[model samples]
Target: MAGVYDFTAQSLAGEDVPLTRFEGQVLLIVNTASACGFTPQYKGLEQLHRDFAARGFAVLGFPCNQFGGQEPGDARQIAEFCETKYDVTFPMFAKVDVNGSQMHPLFNYLKNEKSGLLGSSIKWNFTKFLVDRSGRVVGRYAPTATPDGMRKDIEALL
Candidate 1:
């Protein structure tokens, strides 16, 4: 596959969304887990989305259960938790495997483009991949890297 735009992912609402729809926007693609310690990063991620959306920046969240089954919730439950707890307004996708044989194609492409400390395999929940406006994976951030801390990089892209 080429870049992120080459993939299609299911939305949290069960709609098929072509990544090409976001082709011209700078993206922060994250593997999220509802019950992980990094779950609170949703607030920061939402803040990022709100702060830069007008400038063509977006945060795309993908719920993943590959890590210790931290995100065990179904689509409805995950959507509810995100809306009620973090008031997240960014686009969120359905649950997917971030590693192993069942890994989503988008993530596979991302990891191949920008490997982290774990070398292409996602380390844990909240691992982030920054994509430029052209859909090229530009940066890979570890799970511990806070969304807020990535402002400068995101800003540069915008």
Candidate 2:
């Protein structure tokens, strides 16, 4: 895929969702893991979404189990966990690998567009990629970077 709009991923409910749906919105695409150390970041992500969604901003979460099997749950379980624990209102996709040959196309494009400190491959869960309204990759944040820490950049995009 050349841009964010050229990709599609399965939603948490197993529906194929096209990235084109968010074409004109500033997006924070994150690889999430329910059992990871950064799992609590979901709350912050939800907060960001709630705070900026009215301004054409969104946070898209993609669950991944590749890191220590941190997100070892089915779609329904993950959905319930996110809703009950974090009260997440943003869209979340199904568990997917953010690295390796099996990585989702959207992630593959994101990694290639904005490589991390060392390389394009994701180091762990919770790594975030910021995309502009035009489907352009703007920034890549490490897994350790808290969701709240991205406010400044997200605000700039908005």
Candidate 3:
């Protein structure tokens, strides 16, 4: 894909949503895991979404199980966990493989656009890719990166 808008991912509800729907919004796309230690970051992410959504910003969560099977839940379980535990109201997509040959096309484009400290491949669950309103990958945050710590960067784009 040429950019974020050129791809589409299945949502938690199983609908294919074209990235073009978020064309003019700054996006923070994360490969999430419900059972991971960083799972609690969902709260911070939801807070960020509520805080900046009016300014055209969004946090897109995509569950993954690549790391030690941290996210073992199916779509229903994942959605329930997020909504009940973290009160996550941000957009969430279906689970996907972020590494290896099975990696989703959207993630492939994201990794190629902005590589993390180690390399182009995503390091683990919760790894975040920040995209600008124009669909350019502006930042790649590691799994350890907290949502609050990224506020400054998000503000810069806004």
Candidate 4:
């Protein structure tokens, strides 16, 4: 079966990053938006990244504009907003569709590995998927689920 490491994504900087680069690390993959209410979660996600990076964990952010058109910025704009507003230091990817026919392949794999409350289709932005060190999807979190609330799960995997 395919795992997270089988895919590649474009970073905000336009580099094509192979997910294999993060193979041995626990990862928190989140669909993000700059103008959404859950935007503040970036801070908590960054905290998670800082607190656990030395322990081989990372928070990977993917900007998605599919939900209410909340993240309509270009790559440079998104990068600037995340850095200036939230001081986000975690790795972030370019904008991609999380639902419908145009959905990114990485997201397709993630949703198939762990379906959400509404089934395989994501309901909104900030949806998070937790992957273990072995590249298996271990947990799926809703947009409303706070990053702080997920600490125990993350710690257990770490």
RMSD to native for every prediction?
Answer: 0.7, 0.9, 0.8, 0.5
TM-score of each: 0.98, 0.98, 0.98, 0.99
Question: Which 10-residue window of candidate 3 scores lowest in summed lDDT?
Answer: 115-124
lDDT of 2 by residue, 1-158 (tens): 38899889999998999999998999999999889889999999999999999999999999999999999999999999999999999999998998887988888899889999999999999999999999999999998898889999999989
Compared to the true structure, candidate 1 yields what TM-score? 0.98
Question: What tens digits encode model 1's per-residue C-alpha lDDT throughout 84-121?
Answer: 99999999999999888898988888988998885778
Q: Note the clash tally of each candidate.
A: 0, 0, 0, 0
For candidate 4, lDDT tens digit of each residue in 1-158? 88899999999999999999999999999999999999999999999999999999999999999989999999999999999999999999999999999999999999999998879899999999999999999999999999999999999998
lDDT of 2: 0.93
Q: Could you give me the TM-score of model 2 versus the true structure?
A: 0.98
Q: Please give the lDDT score at residue 85 for candidate 1.
A: 98
Q: Which has the greatest lDDT? A: 4
**Candidate 3 per-residue C-alpha lDDT over 1-158 given as tens digits, one digit per residue, 9 for 90 to 100:** 39899999999999999989999999999999998989989999999999999999999999999999999999999999999999999999999999899999999989888888888988889999999999999999998999999999999999
Error of model 4, residue 111, in angstroms: 0.5
Q: Give model 1 RMSD, 1 decimal.
A: 0.7
TM-score of 3: 0.98
Q: How are the candidates ranked when ordered by lDDT, highest leading?
A: 4, 1, 3, 2
Please list the residue runs of candidate 4 whose C-alpha ends up more than 4 Å from where it truly belongs after superposition.
none
After superposing candidate 3 on the true structure, give the runs of residues whose Cα lies further than 4 Å from its correct spot. none
